[model samples]
Target chain A: MNTADIKNEKSVRYHGVGISNGCVSGPLRFFRQRRKMGRIRACGDQREERARFEQALLRTREQLDTLQRRAIREIGKKEAEIFEIHAMMLEDEDFLEAVQGALDDGACAETAVERAAEKHAQALRSLGDPYLSARAEDLHDVATQLLRQLSGERPDGDLSTEREPYILVADDLSPSETVTMEKSMILGFVTFGGTPNSHTSILARAMGIPALVGVGAVSEDCDGAYALLDAAEGTLTVSPDAEERCAFEEKQREVNDLAREHDRYLRSLINKPAITRSGRKILIYANVGEGREIAQALLNGADGVGLLRSEFLYLSMDRYPTEDELFASYHDVVQSMQGKRIVIRTLDIGADKQIPYFALPQEENPALGFRGVRICLAREEIFKTQLRAILRASAYGNVSVMVPMIVSEDEVRACRVILNECMEELEREGKKFDHGIEFGIMIETPAAAIMSDEIAREVDFFSVGTNDLTQYTLAADRQNPLVERICEENREPILRLIEMAAEAIHRHDGWIGICGELAADLHLTQRFIDLGIDELSVSVPYLLGVREKVTECK
Target chain B: MKEFTYTIEDPNGMHARPAGKLATYAKQFDADIRVHAGEKESDGKRLLALMSLGATCGTELHFIISGSDEEAACEQLERFCRESWGRGE
Candidate 1:
């Protein structure tokens, strides 16, 4: 009844996941593309058929080159790579060979290009790799470009005519097409199908244009109608009445004011240390998995890296990496850190992170089965190799070694013994390493949190990995939606455990840090500060926000 | 023929960008450059062929250059891979 009333009096609404927080009221414009073409009745002449195919290729190349140059001028070279890839696809020997074979079989130029591109695209679709499978669309994109050129369809004849700003809508958009759009006239984008992680959404957010994606299809009849798109609210109210537009305009202004306020406040806290009113200072650190993200973390003013997963080294490899490979990778990251502490976690694989070479057995419950420190403990050589590499990398910067899924004191003792053995071996080999590198363990298990005093006595520090602590504490899997509320309602229990662990660690003169999902929770930032966490390590984007919150705390 | 092995160090590893760059670079040489990753071999001058190799980060890319200017192609391309594509870190 409420839905019916809202639809009747104000507008009909379409919902989607919003990428940016702004809102705009503008005319809606759906992207239209020509797909079906009249079949060409080719003469039984092989030479002319081949010439036609060749001409289409040349025209497509010139168009792509123009798009590439424009993209470089407007969006930069990185985005222009999309067109470069298309150009290469247009000239690929395999693709050309397929087209030539089709031409030899007396098919027309359009039929040959379509058949060849479809064959390759079908092969790619069956590859089962989501990333590689997406390339099938790129093939179709290039093929469509060639077909349009072959049919003498003029490009850019209509885009110049849309002078007024409109919220563009599409089923999907290639990166090149999105980059080449006139930015000044684009109010926003509303895609019928796109994830926030898609290149289109990322580009939209980077351009500071609000976008509503994964909204299902908007009817063709709704085109040119005035729609108020509230991206923060993830609602598109088509044909909105004056009252609804006024409400949305007021909401947009308030949202913009809040963002402006946050921006100004965050800038002030950038270089300054986040100190509470009681003179307690909190360290803002970043959790990263890849080396490329380190640059962004430092750019965002992270004091240090709290949790460098160190699994990227393992994940990137076709096989187990040699000690030198591991050391060289870590050395690059360590040097780039420029003396800031990088807490390198040892191989935390086994459960969901299994390599084929490891031959880990499938379990009924993989999360509860052999994982993290358990895998490292059973595979001591892999553990020692990582420890040796991290210790060696410590020569360049303030590097710390952290262990994950550690639930017992014995695991800590075993890891320390192996670390000590590795250190002695490195010393015996006349290799350089930092002798006093700090060692820490993730307090993720409820058992570890309860046994914090004993665990704290053995380790230099404790970083609460709240993600797993919440999972194990609540006995709920994060991937399961049925028990999501059970996990949410029981967050206080996890915080209480963190409090207990913090007290125990502080008693032992060991500083505590939170490096899990909870670390970025601004609402719980004060609660974390009250619990005596000396450091809060979040992802790159949350660094300043957490720092800003800390400064406002008592 | 001149052949050498270099491990791919870029995190994205032989994806579209690097593969396109590799293809474009190889097309400039008179020599035929064939790159092998694991069991898969690809025409270095072809983007789709190189991407089909699926050489991920840490996967060794073995390059074999043969024909006229093989020595120069081998020398320059090896240098390019080492300097530009050597380390994702």
Candidate 2:
């Protein structure tokens, strides 16, 4: 097996779909599935065969129970549920009956279990539902366990003898196989056949291990070879030369440093304020789409919910969501924030984000057409319902109302009138709400940026929606691939508009924040700090990185 | 015999989670239960059997119960259908 001297060998590169993101270098070890040592001959005694089958079932059950407990401890309960389901499948009458019938025909317990599993697996495959059919693999996992028990074979092959962590190479891995192995001993995974949606891929992602799947066949001789597995680039290099090895080590060090610095080091500073060197306290918040993401936002250490797009509830429903339904969602999100400032933007749907039930007439350029506050003001009842819900939720926590797409003071005053009516209605109904909840507007349109001075006085704060501002200011449609370069290159004009809004809002003693894609751009963190932006709100994943960038900035 | 029909509203349909839940729940009943999905039918007490029915979203499940505990089983199964698969939203 020691055919090639790894040091003198030329490097071999293999490509596949990168299911997880990371880079690792190690000696490659092929994980071979432990098959039952040959065919099982029928035992003459039927009762003895029955006893053997029963004992194997009992042992398999115990092993599954242990795996379930270990999985729950190491991984999450959600991932561990597969083991619970497998345990249930063990006692499934169809499976047990098939196995018993095969045993009655004088087949050994191993053959009986194998045949029964194949029969049920074939039946499941013929069902034609892809998700259900995938359970065949799970069924096979259970059968393999049973066979192992009957044959008294070890759960895994002898890879535990290796001293250092090795890259696990296999044809594909079952969920049981992935979970049962010691994750600490494995650096990464390279599979010959699997998908991004495979159980192994999902487990690898959940465990934060780099993996490449569906890479086609790798030679058995490559085993024990020094390798570089960079799942970020979806490539595995075997027996890399000195130069290649140097490059691989450099990349691996950078990835390791980043994972350690950003995830561990930055996460330690999550509760700390994202204060700049010049002593500007820039609040870091998360832009979440729905109530379900509130937990994630909180976990990522968002100081507040900066931009809660209210369109999710409306878009999910066939008709408009009722005020109570909207209130239920908003109430949960607000309560979860636990008195942290949560800015809930009213429904900003239009031609691009049309709810079929809205039934607005199609326009030539929907972006320039009636949208945001225009649609809300046109439909006062919808706007009022949302306002009432937000107001109702204000009683629980620090909630704020932020209007979207305001081009003029007229639109601001119009929304104010409707908001006041909703407050009055709430007052009459005796609903307890924060009477002095903060009000703000999204500075998206160029006209809104130009008229920020007049608009800032009416609202408590301003949050610049830079995605829309960039497209509108540059006269470039963001979705157009042809003008994508134009949109990407032109940031100075958008930054200037944001600077104007920041100055105007600060003049009124109201703070300004950027709740846009640009907010997370670390390149502009120093630029944004210079412009006197009070807050930055990005998606949950970028929260920590942006926080790190803010501290890195002058 | 007690019988009722329910359309699977869960987008993923009778996958492992729901099927296992159904099998586990049906095991508690003394009544003989059978679930039918389109042309295929399965013993409600078995997880693999229920899964073999391959019921996807929009597939109607006709549940038939027969035994001494049929009435209680019928009522409970109906409630489960309304609570779990009932959200036609």
Candidate 3:
């Protein structure tokens, strides 16, 4: 259908599966522009095919640049830069030569691009680095998207024209495409494929959309069926009975009203401490992973950054971030916080999170294997680089360095030794810093929690990583759905660990921060308050909710 | 021309709200306001450029202003640095 034809339609239904959260309602728009793909005859000579392949590559490069510029204009500069990386992929001589080789075998330009993308994707997957492997998926998606754009076929599907707010169903939406959707028009999202860790899901959650992912065939059944979606419950009903529709509508309204009321209350309490009626005070902090998150955390009323995941800086790069790169990143966070507290967790890469560039050995039981503080112990160079970066950043603002996955006092001491060494190195260089820059340990392992008293003596504070703690305490693999029920955040054992850790740290005159998904739990906010957690570090979006909960508890 | 050296005491450096606020302040005066860290210089009235400078806390920066109201621009920026950008104030 032509753009005008689709735009003029009053209402239409194009169905797929929902993958992420949130609802948007707006005019149905379709991005149907395709990239032009040059065809090569099957009997073409190697030289002829090679020339055609090069021409196609040049055209693809131009198309990518144009898309990238449009992306920059539509989104922000940072997001647009993601496309630049893809453009770099197109320019890789080795990759281009491989595609040319395929085209010389009598493959069309489209087939050659697809074949090359698949080969590179498999190679990346075999590398076994999640982030690097994920990049392979990104490369594959981008190449396919670019090829399709060149082939005169739209990779993105048509948007419906129905005025009524409806959920978008898709196989999976890329982060870039998800951002392009008008927020006003999307009612919600349902996808057949996508994990919570996917960037699209993260963005949807950030956008506050109710999303249900992995609902196998719901999208096909819901086609043109005026559906009702309960995102909180991860339920989608296609053509529900009248009563169910009425009930869902009422529930949606109630949720909207409550959200509005909560927003107003949070605005009123922005400048106020999260104190209960009984004068109990709780500090609300942000769990930041990157520099961008620091600004978001501050805007959401975070008094400081509770957990700055340092892995992002090391990932997606060719080598260890130079001290200058590290300094610049940390400086960005410190400057953005405007002097608010920033607790940075040193590189926590291990089994589950790997940096292919580092080439760490793959372990059978990665969870209990070489990771966290253990990895740092063996790879002192990587650890020291991070320490130096954090230390140099400390010279900038209220920055504290924390070691993750600590299991014993010795690990704490060893980390402290390296940190001090780095600090001493800086001191010898005549660099000034908060000599008393606070050092902390992530109490993820049960052994660390049990030995909190001893660890506390060596550090300034403790931050309980509830996500890992729950998994370890329950002896349940978090990724295993069979034991999902046992991994409940509000379970008795998890709460007790938090209570115990907080008490132990408090006895030593040390503070404790919780930087887990549990920190954002509305139901557990009061419990955290009661446990006397010095800081509740949550995702930025949950800051207001946490602030209100803290205030109401007071 | 007026130049002053200051440390970025505000956490998160000169980004987001602070950068926007500083940009607004810069536009109020008829000065050629520029912020420099090492070799990087940014338009003091543009938040994007200022943020790209990545000036974080404890990083020494030079605020250079020239033309009319140069003194006012320097004074305002200096005050922001010294007072911790009014965060939690």
DockQ, per model, reads 0.13, 0.30, 0.01
Model 1, which residues run further than 4 Å from truth?
A1-261, B1-89
Q: State the iRMSD of every prediction, in order shown.
A: 11.4, 11.4, 17.3
For model 2, residues A1-554, the per-residue Cα lDDT tens digits are 11222344477788888877889989999998755444576575888889988999998998887688567545655677889889999989899999999988888777889889999999888978767767887898899888888778776665767779999999888877887676668899988877775678878987778999878888898999999888888888898999998998899888877776646887797889888776778899988877766777888789998999888788779998899999998898888997799999998988866688999889888889989999999989899999999999999999989999999999999999888998999999999899999999999999999999999989999999998999899999754423556887888999999999999999999999999888888899999999999899987767888998898788
List TM-scores for all candidates, in order: 0.54, 0.53, 0.56
lDDT (C-alpha) at residue A422 in model 2? 89
lDDT of 2: 0.85
Give the lowest summed-lDDT range of ten residues in model 3 chain A. Answer: A1-10
Decoy 1 TM-score against native: 0.54
Top TM-score hit:
3
Candidate 2: regions farther than 4 A off: A1-209, A212-262, B1-89
lDDT of 1 by residue, A30-145 (tens): 77755545467655488887787788888788778767755643443455567878888989998999898888888888888889988887766565545555666788788888
Instruction: Give model 1's clash tally.
Output: 0
lDDT of 1: 0.82
True contacts kept of 3: 0.00
TM-scores for chain A, candidates in order?
0.61, 0.60, 0.63
lDDT of model 2, residue A425? 91
